[model samples]
Target: MGGDLSQTEVLVIGAGLSGAIACQRLARAGIGVTCLEQGEWNPRESYPGDKPDFELQALGPWNANPNIRRGKADYPILDDTSDIKPLLFNGVGGSTVMFSAHWMRFLPSDFFTYTLDGVGTDWPIDYHELEPYYLQTEADIGVSGLAGDPAYPDRPEYPMPPLPIQPWGEKVAEAHDRLGWHWWPGSNAINSRLHQGRRPCVQRSTCRAGCNEGAKGQADQSIWPSAIAAGAKLVTGARVARILTNPQGRAEGALFVDEFGVTRKACADIVVLAAHAIGTARLLLKSVDAAWPDGLANSSGVVGKNLMMHPMNRMVGFFDEPMSSWQGHWGQSIYSMEFAETRAEHDFARGAKWNLSPTGGPLNAALYPLDDPQPFGVDLHDRVDKWLGRSALWGMVAEDLPDSHNFLTLDSAHSDVDGDGLPRLHYETSENSKRMLSFMAKRARESFGAAGAYEVAEQTLAAEIGWHPLGTCRMGNDPRNSVVDKWNRCHDIPNLLIVDGSSFVTSSCVNPAATISAIAARAVDRLIHCRSEY
Candidate 1:
């Protein structure tokens, strides 16, 4: 539980995608980097093979008792008035372990939100500025797909070819084309051609749970191994409580509780916080001191403000033919944006894109069609059986604008077993976001109808809780409106860098992982060049 802190050059707090990539880059640069993860490192063999076991690992065990336990200590969940539930990963690989492998880059327009559309703040850097880094990240991650697809930017074709399209995927693509929607093989981190000594995807339907076949690109399988080989150290079961700053107001180290429930300190010349959006913000707020009365980097008072979650909605359709939607990777096929650009011309509140998703297992599928159940028994079983393979589901991921009201704060009442306060999230869909959701629902219905679905049922608007959370510690040129600067260095604390979803100014319609990796890589490049002076 103890280590020599003086020898560490860079300390990364969280071993997620961003943290893993950053640590790798730092190690490649010959920097002595140490990564601290709150959960134990579960190897590929540790993943479950059965569906019930997979469900328990993926969603059930956490849901049954919403507390993170590292050995004997339990981290409690704080209840907030917000309708949305904050979900985050606490392990070494972080959410990348359970991610659907959708590695999509944000559109060019996603960066210049202010100049192009005037709805959100413009990024200090744009797509063109990040183009090279995006290409590097894609190559590093071994992305699988063809380039020259109109939906994505022109770049080198994916390092690996696209996975073999499933029958359900082909059907969904046909349906999308018939409805004049753009459809393409999704850019995935899963291997299609078995590059880098990893095997190709075996078409396992259980990607949401950890992948045992090494097809899905979790950091543990991809970046962590390389980082460790390059002399970087990864310390798991180390929960970072707060960043410790020197009197000179520079980040020197962190205060953390190790696996044995013992308080420890780790020092580094530079500290990078990559604990996703909520975790990063919560940690910053918890590091309050006399120099930083409000929070470590809250001079602008926007550390945990302007939180955004891309509220996701789904439309499930039942067909006469068997679609077999659950046979492939979680997000292997995507119906592109024939409608994503609608906001460019129309008066739409916001835009959305429909992507093909797994239809779920029997128990999960039954809940989707249950608006009101008829007489139970054989009739219900018959109805479920008939629609099992014949169903195709499409998810609409719409961008939710950043609002100051949607935020994360520490709850005084709920403290973890380690005596650390829990983060209580307060967020709801804005009126504008609700309108956009309705517009997207209509468009999804039209697409399903064109696909000749026997029954198209749009999901009811439940509480807006999604895995894609962003913009809590947004980066911008204006210090008053944002938490970090263009370089992602905290405005108030020059030595501390926040590189993750928390730095996103706006949540794009697509997955934010690619962008997050690109930004972290860019930040590392900056850190390397100015290390001697800083």
Candidate 2:
């Protein structure tokens, strides 16, 4: 059977936020770029606000839909291993499709955690190096927040205004103020005002179900469109099986399977692995050949070693007043950075933020209360309905240290639906991580108490799951302890760049996407400058 093989100046695997930004930057530099996504190109109109569809996308089956799940299907986790669940997205925009749009850059101290606090690994590049790029990315994605916030870096003003504070936000802020905690409007990727061609957020609450209003700036609605408009080619439903390397051990292209399961080859002068942390590391580990038997860029055996995920726990509170928590952007509202800074003398874990998350609809709310095995009846329904609007839910996203034990390995028994062995996550929170989470949970409890919550209930740590997984393929100055260099180019394979959460050396206390995008932009600039040498 005949098949198609194509070539471009640069080939980006995964069409998620990082891949989309990389493609956009590369294409704007006059480079020929092609982005291959495992999921279809789902437009904004396809996302509907329905409980069943939302639950399906958040749970299974439809969860792999790029329009819904993003690139979650590429890396399935065995959440049943422990009580804690692991969430991943499968699709073009990846997890950004369903992410909370919490666009936060790590504090300057986050980069020097090990050096300053004597814990974890220090980032090869510091916040100063990434500050400019962070500003650029924030502007590019239309982040909304005020500058001069003590919790964040002193940066330029956000492109758009902050999302309107909700009743829950006001309450949280009041609690923080009373407790002497630092609180601010979270830097969100959702548009608060009109920017570019996108419309302002209409205060529609179901952002996880996919924003039909085109306000939340997922890659599909933001960078991917700009990249495609700038002459970049996006091929969806294409799964990259492995990276193709020359005899010199330099990456040349990739072997991919199309939607029809037809094997094809695409040669490129440069290959970028933006397939998230686990997927990128797995691809490198799977690309063994004559020159490198272990993996493509596994000379240091650190491709998947320093796997880190932000373990999160939620604190639910019921109030007598009507807050209507589910009335606006899912990620919109307030953030508390009171505990984000590390204190070596305090013997405390890293600080966590308490952000106001959307109050779930009927089905999602059911999952929470039903954890107690309560009988389903009118009492349950009445309780759920009464608490639904008045409840204020806050999530504690604490940092997890990178450990060899918390890693991703190929599951020998599990395979994709097509029988290809999918990468299995062999992750467990370290003792230190659990301790940190416990510390953060205690703080969350205090915050809830201060908020005058009538009944504050903290979920058990066993129910905590990591949504932001980072540092699977970290970048460093030396290849001995890292997968890629400071410029994000693989040490063994100079032409191969891994730009994503995978390149993070340390899991910061904040969300990773803003940092990832800034790093990708910086890498693209470096790649462009070194194009002639290549």
The 0-to-1 C-alpha lDDT of every candidate, in the order given, reads: 0.76, 0.77
True-structure lDDT of candidate 2: 0.77
Q: Model 2 compared with the native: what TM-score?
A: 0.94
Q: Identify the leading candidate in terms of lDDT.
A: 2
Per-residue lDDT tens digits of candidate 2, residues 1-534? 346556799999988889999999999889999988887776776676544466545554444222223343454555445334555566778778877788888888888888887778888899989988898888777788778788866787889889977877787788889999888987799999887788888876767756777788888887887898898999888888889998877788988888887988888999999998877887887777778777778998887777777777777777788777657778848888887887675465566666776676655666664235653687678668756777777777777767777676656587755454556566676666566767877777777778877777666563445567789898898889898999999988889999999999888878888999999999988999889755
User: Over 4 Å off in model 2, which ranges?
Assistant: 50-75, 79-84, 369-371, 416-420, 462-464
Per-residue lDDT of candidate 1, residues 245-318 (tens digit): 99888999898888787888999888899988888988888888799877888889988888887776777777
TM-score of 1: 0.94
Deviation in angstroms for 182 in model 1?
1.7
Residue 369 in model 2: lDDT: 40
Task: State the displacement of the C-alpha of residue 196, model 1, in Å, after optimal TM-score superposition.
Answer: 0.8
Q: Which ten residues in a row are the worst by lDDT in model 1?
A: 64-73
